[model samples]
Target: MHNVHVITHPLVQHKLTLMRRKDASTNSFRRLLGELSTLMAYEVTRDMPLQDIEIETPLETMTAKVIDGKKLVLVSILRAGNGFLDGMLNVVPGARVGHIGLYRDPQTLQPVEYYFKMPSGMHERDVIVVDPMLATGNSAAAAVQRIRDMRPRSLKFVCLLAAPEGIATMQQAHPEVPIYTAAIDRELDAHGYILPGLGDAGDRIFGTK
Candidate 1:
């Protein structure tokens, strides 16, 4: 609870509810996710550092505050993580984008990374990792660990929904990095899906299933 932030804004809650419905179409789910991601991104970057810069209005010059262009980096955890990327990009169009491809080993239920690519000068940027569902948290933890190896200036994890198990897993692995989620579901099912979750995010978003 200390480092986990649950966004309770009315708009965010409303959109998340629509996403959780059992009958929502793929198009509806994808559209809702895109809109919800934009709202989540607003909360994720609310505390980003800003510097005062000289600017001119129509009539007079004044000091204007702006976030550091190079201060932010978005790392999508492949597949489902890509769902949050485009919407978040709308919020921070200039932010650099990165991707980390990982899949859960069905037998071991552990994350196996097959690809990793990040922006240059990661050490100077604040990395925000995106993944839709944090069911077991293994993939999120592994992805964060890989990014940590890069020694970025800061780190944060954002997800649409998370389970208690997932949250604890991430906390134990990286307590310093806060988690932002729209909701914390009841629990994870035997198959590692979050109970009452919106189902497989990548599948729903991409109509894969």
Candidate 2:
């Protein structure tokens, strides 16, 4: 569990409860997701390196802390991840954005990558893979593997919610990378959905269903 950080912020918990209600509207769902992602981003970037630099202020020259080295690359895992991208970008406005498109095959329970395009200088940047729910974890695991192939300087997974099974699966597959989430649910349902989870994130955020 060293790599996993479960955020217990009141705002995150409150919005998550709102998101769980069956009657939550698409607009509300989308707005809550943005707010939650912004909070999660704070925890996600807590350990980001910082360096001190001398700067001239209105009064006099003083040392100031700034983000160190490589700028971050926010990699959204397709449609659902896009919801989180906006909020995270609001916090780290200068972070580069990337996309990885994947869909689960209903028959095989496998993730199929349809499209993936990342910033060219991945090796020089820290990457944060965003997805809303880490249920069965097949999609997030696959996405991480694909991103790893690019040899980024560092990589991490960020999600709004996760299931224990999915966390286990992810740890087994990529233990080196840390995972950050607002909550870790009890388990996955028979159909591989997180129990008591806020329905399909993409559908909820986009009103697709």
Q: Point to the candidate with the largest TM-score.
A: 1
What is the C-alpha lDDT profile of model 1 across 99-118, one tens digit per residue? 99999988778999999999
Among these predictions, the greatest lDDT belongs to: 1
| Model 2 residue 2 CA deviation in Å | 3.6
User: What TM-score, computed on C-alpha atoms, does each candidate reach?
Assistant: 0.98, 0.96
Cα lDDT of model 2 by residue, 31-103, tens digit: 9999999988988998888889999999999999998433799999998999999899888888899999999
lDDT (C-alpha, whole model) for all candidates: 0.94, 0.91
For every model shown, the clashing-pair count is: 0, 0
Candidate 1 residue spans exceeding 4 A from truth: none
Compared with the true structure, the alpha-carbon lDDT of candidate 2 equals: 0.91
TM-score for predicted model 1 compared with the true structure:
0.98
Local error of candidate 1 at 9, Å?
0.6
lDDT of 2 at 136: 88
